[model samples]
Target: MKKKLGAYLTNRKIMATALLALTLALSACGNSGEKANEGSADKETRDITIKIGYQKYGTINILKADGALDKRLSEERNIKIEWIEFPGGPQLLEALNVGSLDLGHTGEAPPIFAQAAGAPLVYLAHEPASPQSEGIIVPKGSPIKSVADLKGKTVVLNKGSNVHYLLVKQLEKAGVDYKDIEVKFLPPADARAAFEKGSVDAWVIWDPFLAAAQTATGGTILVDGTDVVSNHEFYLATRAFAEKYPDIVDILLEEADKIDVWSKDHPQELAEKLSPQLGIDVESLLLAAGRRNYGVQPIDEELIKAQQAIADTFFNLELIPKKLDINDAILK
Candidate 1:
């Protein structure tokens, strides 16, 4: 009887071991299925449609036109990109302010004015100043030789632009008051026509507009912002967009860094590449390309202080309607 009981107990132990193995195998299959489903969900989440805005002069233009960013992101993730372009900073920022755009690139001045106007935008990146890119240009034969001589002449320019501060700084350096000149605000296309038609005596602008005008019209640059001011450009996003898509912003900045490096190393080559987009010759583009500071950097307190200085000058001169605290618009 003892021998029979021992055999029975041994048989029951073997059965219990087999049951444990079967239970674990079933759980493993269940987890595998759940993990596959989770992966599918992740792929669906990455199928984002972010709307980005750009200007021809910005470094963002370089990356988008070259197809580098899209190519890289598409390779790594499931995503779609939509690009919307505008002529200049003012219009580009206008789109962002109105909730029509997600991200935009603009010169320092426009953001100040836009923020003052209650545009719900915030800074994401800062491009350091390329001082030589912006300045006051007069015709080769024009008697208005100096910034001081600019007094009482109609100066055509994009209002609330980077060059606006250029004009102010130039005037101060030349011992001419900011109020000395007649300011005629216009976009680059209109300003170019006005300048050529002799509608305006002097043109305060930034390159490649400055470069194109110089090469095409033999316009002599009277002064550049490099001497007294740094016209740092900025990338901004609508608060709504920035909040919704932090990952895309990282991707943009990453690509922008690559383009910036390429632009600096191959200025002439970059000009050739950008010619079709800008509607200007590579030679002319090269002339102004050097003036552009292709530094892709994050927004910081120093950039904020520089931009605030511009705002203060504008308010003191009453260019914008009211005072602006530039730091308020910075996202982070």
Candidate 2:
């Protein structure tokens, strides 16, 4: 009887030990499976960073200042934004070419030159032409009175900028040959310096620089873009970036449109917000904000044709190495 009882106890102890081991093994397997799922979740939730290039002033600046883009992209998509500022559109497009920027804003001309230079860019949207936003200005007491009077005189402008097309068209209207004037290609800062020193006969510039020049120097407007050029501001992105993350592009445009709506309704508030970002006083910024026509529209047939005309003009003048079909750079 004692041997049988001992045998039963031994068997029971063995069964208990086996059960404990099995429980621990199952728990370990469950932990491993959980870890695998967590790894996948980490991968899926990783944040995406988008690099955006912008100029000193414009809707992009307003967008950046508003902080709505960053907030929306972060909360909704787990995406991060990186903002880069360029001196001008040409420089911005150059960064796009080198893959440093995923998206950026520019006036009409820079993209044309960039496209001709083989930058794989796609236009996303554009602001309607704000003709009075840019102009040719001479100092307060300069002898140069009209666009036609710029003949054989030195004119400074940012090369391959929106104002570049403006200068060309205005000169054509005044019956001045492109070669007749001594053209000096300088960025806005340098051009303004030269203008102040009377080194350049006239400065072809866009606002807030135009407004600043006019306010500070009391310069007279020789000719603005009125009835001359459609100085459209474009939103551009690299082909790869746009193709891989189209949703991000759409979000950006949507946010920009929102800012545009807000800006158009609140000019004083817009100027106040932009004054610090642009480093221009509120008055000049107000002038710039006033003249600016704000709206974000998709690239359409008429817009494309207008852009193509600019491209053709550049090609005919040998400003670009090759002719460009503006449609090629447009987002489908």
Against the reference, the lDDT scores of all candidates come to 0.78, 0.86
**CA lDDT for candidate 2:** 0.86
Which residue ranges in model 1 land beyond 4 Å of their true spot? 1-45
* CA error at residue 315 for candidate 2, angstroms: 0.5
Model 1 C-alpha lDDT per residue in residues 1-332, reported as the tens digit of each score: 22332343345445544744655555567877555554342344376766788876678888887898888777766676789988678888888878788887888788888887889999887776788888888886999877788888889888777787778788888888776778988999999999998889999888788888998999899888766987777888988776655556666776787788788899878988899988988877898887777766766677778888888888888878899887788764
Give me the displacement of residue 116 in model 1, in angstroms.
0.4
Which numbered prediction scores highest in lDDT against the true structure? 2
TM-score of each: 0.85, 0.86
What is the alpha-carbon lDDT for the whole of candidate 1? 0.78
Candidate 2 per-residue lDDT over residues 1-332, each given as its tens digit: 22442353355456545754655555567877545554332233338788999997889989999999999989976888999998899999999999999999999999999999899999987887899999999999888888889999999999999999999999899999999999999989999899999998999999899999999889999889999887999999999887666556667877887899899999899889888878899999888988889877777788899999999999999999998888788766
Task: In angstroms, give how far residue 51 of model 1 lies from its true place.
Answer: 2.1
